[model samples]
Target chain A: MTTVPVRPPLVRSSDRIVAGVCAGLAEHLGWPVRMVRIGMAVASLAGGAGLVFYGWLWIMVPTADESAKRNARRPASPIAPAVSIAPSASMPPKHAAAVDPPLWTGAYSPGYPPGAVSTPPGGSAPAAGPGGYTPAAGPVPSVPYDAGAPSQPQEPSAVPSTGAWFRVRNMRYGKEILLGAGLLLVAAILIARLLGVEVPLGTLIPAAAILGGAAIAWMQLDETRRAGLVDKTKADQAGGWARLAAGLALVVAGVLVMVSGSGSWEQTWLALLASVAVLGGVALVLLPWGLKFWRDLETERAGRVRETERAEIAAHLHDSVLQTLALIQRRAANEHDVVRLARAQERELRGWLFRDPARDAGQLSDRIKAAAAEVEDGLGNAVDVVSVGDTAMTDRHEALVQASREAMLNASRHGGGPVSVYLEVSDGGAEVFVKDRGSGFELHAVPEDRMGVRESIIGRMKRHGGTAEINSSPDGTEVRLKLPAAAEDNGEGKS
Target chain B: MSTPALDGTAGDRGRTVRVVIVDDHAIFRSGLKTDLDPRIEVVGEAGTVERAIEVIGRTRPEVVLLDVHLPGGLGGGGREVIAGSAALRGTTKFLALSVSDAAEDVVAVIRAGARGYVTKTISGAEITDAVYRVAGGDAVFSPRLAGFVLDAFGTAPADIADDELDKLSARELEVMRLIARGYSYKEVAKELFISIKTVETHVSAVLRKLQLSSRHELTKWAAERRLL
Candidate 1:
């Protein structure tokens, strides 16, 4: 779906360090401003690309509120300027803010809802964060199911995907082919005996000699070519199930021929068919499973390799970012807002560091922690999150995290005291309970404009293959969000 | 805002509790200095592990607020500070104040003789109470961190067979650690001063033993086990 014409986040006139670009980006994207600036600064390392990019973003991208006014008047000026930027200098700074002075050091992240799928190759990488580590988003092989198709028309981005597939399809197995041929020859000999052909048994001697010569020829192929003979799902293995059934039928026919035809006409024809069927059945049933086992081994090996990569990333994050953030927290001065930002940033960094790539959110406990921190950062309050049971990583984790965050926000706004979050994970699924001691409001009392309770909380759970159970009274309010084990297909959230 | 830095006989018990805050960050130290319970006196503070040892030695505070990561002398972390101040172990207590609740950090500090390890999230009152408890020779840890300690050093550790680690070479272990932390394959290669090709080989071997599907699953597995 084509979203509304994109506009730059507004510069927080009150919180600008240098034109509030970083602040705007951070606020707009729910990312740490410092990281955004750092990311911009890092992007600059590409031979002043960062500076030039930041400059264009400054002049072109309108502020958030102003964009609303502009959108009302007309559609955005057809998505970005044609010659978006000069190769170097000689760029005009148009449509000045009129209030704030032009500052060289700022860029705002585009405004997107929290947990939205980040459309990249545009936004400052720092602003695109769950674990805040997309800066390292190098090439990833596309999924096997869609390896043949890519949505983007121009770019040929399926090289690695095709490469993996090619390796699998091209593989061959010589030993199986040779064995099949040998089995067929044995069946042929049995059939010939039953047929009572004019040729004697000595005629088969030359056939054996020819088979040995073919085996010798097979040994001449190179090691790689020879190894190809071990293929699992090649042409030789196709009608295995059919062959099994036919072999049983043929065996019955051969025995019948031996019994009935012996007393009447020629029994050799019946014996030949029966013996051949038995051979086909036994080979089809046993050999295919061998191929299946081999294929499983290949996938398992690949899985192990991926696991190692993830573990390495986690370890590096532990030593580098996690530790560094801790030290910074202890050392940095208590600039109230800065300290709060640091705490929030620390939690986000942790989340980003440990997140599962499959889901925007990682473990259940992690989602709870992130939601709690986000709530605390947005609304100044203490959220104590207690997790119970081993957390399972599931695709629905991001949706669940989103719902929990909204519930926490609702609690902090209406609830009277500290928010207590309890996350319970079990075999069936996970349940997050956000409880606050504040005076509760009736569910029906919520106004139409407010989307927190209705859409964010309840709607999110339903789309995520789960449910949100909210209970409130004068005593307090508790939002128990339930998630099913087999989560539904994602990305169906409605406004 | 109204009270002096110290009030006469601030504690109900009529005695002042002395403290030394050791952390690399100046702001956190200053904040701690102001927010500390009135009865607790901030005698001295240092940022590096070496200075922390010296400050704690000179101040001989009853309780030392230690951060896990510092600047000097053998990585200058809290565990180092605790080990350096072994001479004052019986008289002085070390309460680790850190942002990390990672099992590794917690267990390392606690194993190195920290009286307690509380995360920075705790409020001043809770920290003060923890300090007092540690001063009285009691051990303390964050609820989550305590679990890490138990899992790492508790009775279950032996059954888990730390020896399974023997199967991995030191290099492989290093590779596993970097991958587990969520580093990109290329980044791991750069950090370890090895070729990306070598990293891939090592990764294959590590995954083979771990029996995991991919880096994503590996990250989750490491997190669940608290190895990360």
Candidate 2:
């Protein structure tokens, strides 16, 4: 005999008289509709059991149209029915024979598209045999029967390949399967009690406790797993925390049920204590794993930071040092050019390497150094600057730096030897001494026409309420600029 | 013009000073050797700390012009060489030369028993003079080194006792300031109305205090005021 199709889901049919309950049940069970109707009528007259059963079925079983709508809304995998069903249809006869007959005859058909039952032709005929029966006269069509509904093509077509009878079609249904099994167990127990069967509370309560606890834990775990598949938001995190709490509560309830269901009061108390100790031991065992996870996270973050810093250093070297080296290589024959390039690159690198990230640009020491560097670049004369202390930049300090720069320029221009600049900031005042080993020219002997030293240096310092002393001897020329502490405060107040 | 005086002084001694140059750059060492006054003789050369120690120990040069930063051996560079040659501390004096004016580096080598510290930019005549002075048992403080010493020791903390050995004497402070202002020892002596011998004595005393004092505060002061 040809393998029969699986039974359809227990949903109310569109063809209905008195809510279509009998018709839906007959179609789900693959029985004649008239038989189920007559049976329901007889049961109602006997004890009103039929009405209660009918009510439960009506509440639990959605109508064909409603289930079809839900199928449309489900975010099922977008694989076409032809791709999924083709493999199952081509299953080897031996593998198909291995499928369990009882499971194939069940009233739930999760793999078939819901549209199979919602179609008018299929809904009206309960004798169509499981709503999945296609005549075996020709090759089975790869396309679903209800191809008109584009959105429903893949909705419920989560059919595992017929060759593997035990393989689940979708992992997302694990929670649903767990929930259904729980409800079925509860129903079976209740029905047994109704039939006057003596069900032991001892066995039933602990069994129910374990099953219920396991269901809740599994559902929460499945939800957490699904949530991880997408980006986690703050709300998802809170939900995760709530799930953890619920799982913990269920575990505690399970423990309590086991303890209470045991032999004697003393045994119950002992079991409760043992469970608490077991939980503590479990926690102690897991503590190191948690700490290791936390340390790994920190190490990963540090590695990322180091990676970024290394990238930045590499980029900087490529941009500045490497480029200068290339230029120097090309100009190797020019001794002066190579020396100048190397010197400039060295200065740039030194500044970059030793830069104080905390220092601001407006500090007195920075400004003086910039000034000295500027003169050295312009005059090709080396100016060595040594700064002992620093103060906030003020108008007086600015004047001092300016005077110092001018003195440096004059010294480098006229001084026959290297120049040195010293800056000292003290509570009494600030002083900048610009000394060059140039043959000294008398202050008066300097023609009035030379305004650089007199006007730029002396004049600027005087305007800022500071003093400039030019000491000249046969040894060298030293220009000393001094800013009193009171003048600095005055400058700050004025500003 | 100052060359004549330096040459005359060395000529009066009638012997060239023995020297060893320790620098990583071969070009720099050779250039320095060529530019130095004929009154100084280059007895040996080395490029690394271990080799420097070996040469300094073998040659027993009167002076070692040691680069503050060198390759090989312990990463301590010049300080390691000085420490390694401890047996020859009296006979061989170390004058640190560097391209950087970083305060901590200068202070570290000085604390390691370097007699003087000078930047690489010092003229050949001046380097020759510094070598001679270091050989003569006098400390050679470049203007920058003088500035660093002044800044380190000049600001006396009120909490420190008055007679702390690390504290610079008034004369030593004066000498440091003058040197920091680019005054030669002769000029400083003339400016302070003291003899050149007195200036040298004060500088030597300061150097001694810097090397011998086991003061954490001095080191902390230098570290805190690093010139970066």
Candidate 3:
């Protein structure tokens, strides 16, 4: 269904008849409102009875006064923008005033009524405001659910009608433009009347102000909504450009209008003339803040991108590389063979050092620590891997070190118990033992070809005339590796 | 078509073996391939599942050295080798060239029909001999891998033996062996067959004594000893 245009009820002007019927009708129809007023005036003069119709219509049609009541009765959509919370009275008046600019010095002051109650303060005790009076608890209004047409009451107290009036503030830009134009039109007319000058354009000023304000407000909301979806950095950059463009346009237009309106340069009013210059200066000053906001937004976006990349790398390593190695170890039956397989896998990974084809390079350290910590985490701080032989292995000796690392990696990841890594070094060689306090495997009975045993112990030791001795019973398992003295002493450290 | 007997090469040392190295990893293949000596001729190389198959099919060198793991799928290399068994029947022998010495991978490739299994870390000279040996249809496996295959084969159960027949005394076992060797009832009446009536008595005595209940067990027992 097509939507009918909905407009705010118009308020009466003072100089013109206090009746607001013409203004309301013009607002609803998108017509020249002045024309409506002139037509109504002519009608009243001709029949004199039209005044009675105006009074009846004014009483029957709803005004802005009913806006709050209508909103509270409306049904809410599940998906809607969060309501903006208004500030409390305790905030300095200056800070609160800066939040929403006023449309005019006179006319409407949109604010909470002095006696209006608020929702209970978020925390325990209630705090006093400027008046130092106890706040009342406003009654929450109940809404009627209608089967056919939905008409809602607007009020902060009514829960269902919130969405209807929620969109009202969206047109704030239009309101500001209208207020500015209206004042200008009234000023021009007053000047013409007081000076007794024939200003041929006086009649069209009010119409221009209302129409221009509506157009500007509509355009601004659309741009802001579109800008909000972009990454914060891009959004900030776009916002800067928009503000700069708007400022430049306003300054140029204001100067042109002031110059054109003056009959002669000598007759210009200096105070009003200086105000135009001030407006242009304000726009220029905003340019830098806009740029700063853009830069901050960009850095934030970059930070988020890096975080996601790191997570992706972690997942890749866990899912593919580590998992594959574990599978090989489990499938192998002999310890000697398992060691060989593990060594091969380790060597394969080392060969890809520069490229880190598996992409787990960053997360590998954490995975090792986590596997070790699993022993502590599961057993509740009962065990820990003290060190991996002083952490002083060279690239050539990495294969040997990796063997022990894999054993620790496996011991920690599997079997629930307290696990500790013990390292001993001498001129003879190095011996690293991964001991677990938990009940151990039934060796010689049901052999478990744990990859760590195969890859780390057997693989490393066999190459250097070293040997791994695993002694296990119902009590626990002690996996010990004895390395060749020559290999250990001469092994280089990893770069 | 056979490659000409490789007598010597540019840096001649001894008779060279024509070899084809197949592995999935470029770095590993390159590392291991460098070990090939002047005594070995590196004929071709393949680094993937399909490429290895194609390269081996075309080269048909003295030895089609391969790996168990290849890119297309897990154990794709082994499957390619085994499936090619029908076509490769005797044209070229497959020597599994691998960095893995896992018993499972080793046994798997052997089952998927590899002639031998060898690790990539082997020295150049040993690898050359491995290629030659496999090409000659002599099974070659890394010592550990060979043991795994041997154990797998050795664990099969043996045929049951007849307890009643085996219970026979040493003299009887020897006599049974000779009787099944082709001594007849008629010959028995003459020399070792026995005296005419005595031969009948001894035959009945032997059957009843062993409790075989039939002559089949006697025949099988003798056959087991390779006496028939």
The prediction achieving the highest lDDT against the true structure is: 2
Candidate 1 structure quality by residue, lDDT tens digits, B7-60: 121123345889999888899989888888798899998989889889998989
User: Which tens-of-lDDT digit does each residue in B1-228 have in candidate 2?
Assistant: 111112222122456899999999999999999999897899999999999999998999999999999999979999999999999979899999998767778888999999988777657877887777888888877777777777777644323345566688676777878787777888887889997878888889888888887777778877666453
Q: Tens-digit lDDT track for model 3 on B120-219?
A: 6555666665565555444543333322322222212223453343344333332332232222233324435454344334433443332332434433
lDDT per residue as tens, model 2, A1-495: 111233455679888998988899877766678987998899888789989978877886789888777657744322222212322333322222212223333333344343333222212112221222334523644233333223232222223232122223133334545666678887998999999998887766766666666766676787767774355689877876776677666666666766676577777677778888998999899999989998997798679879989999999999999999999999999976776677677778878877767777678988998898888778767677777778988766877888999999999999856688889988878899998878888888878988998899888888887889999888888999998888744554232
Model 3 stretches with alpha carbons more than 4 Å out: A1-495, B1-14, B73-75, B101-103, B150-228
- Tell me the tens digit of each residue's lDDT in model 1 across A1-495: 122112333433236665656676665454677887898899899999878867865674556566557545642232232112111111111211100111111222233343222222112211211221232322222231133222222232233223322332233224544565688878887888789855444534444544454434334334336555354465434444344445445445445544453344455565566767987899899898989998997898678778989999889778767776776677677565555556566666765554446543355676577678878888866565656454655557778888888888888888845676766566677777777767888888889888889999998888777889887777567788998665544544322
Residue B8 miss distance in model 2 (angstroms): 8.8
User: Judged by lDDT against the true structure, how good is candidate 3?
Assistant: 0.47
Using DockQ as the measure, the top candidate is 2
Docking class of 3: incorrect
Provide DockQ values for all models, in the order shown: 0.02, 0.28, 0.01
Off by over 4 Å in 2: A1-304, A329-340, A445-451, A488-495, B1-14, B25-27, B71-74, B155-164
TM-score of the second chain of model 2 compared to its true counterpart: 0.90
- Give the chain B TM-score for each candidate: 0.62, 0.90, 0.56
RMSD of candidate 1 to true structure, Å: 28.3
Each model's lDDT comes to: 0.57, 0.72, 0.47
TM-scores of all predicted structures: 0.38, 0.58, 0.25
Tens-digit per-residue lDDT, A236-298, candidate 3: 668756755665455444444445563455444564467668876986898799889999988
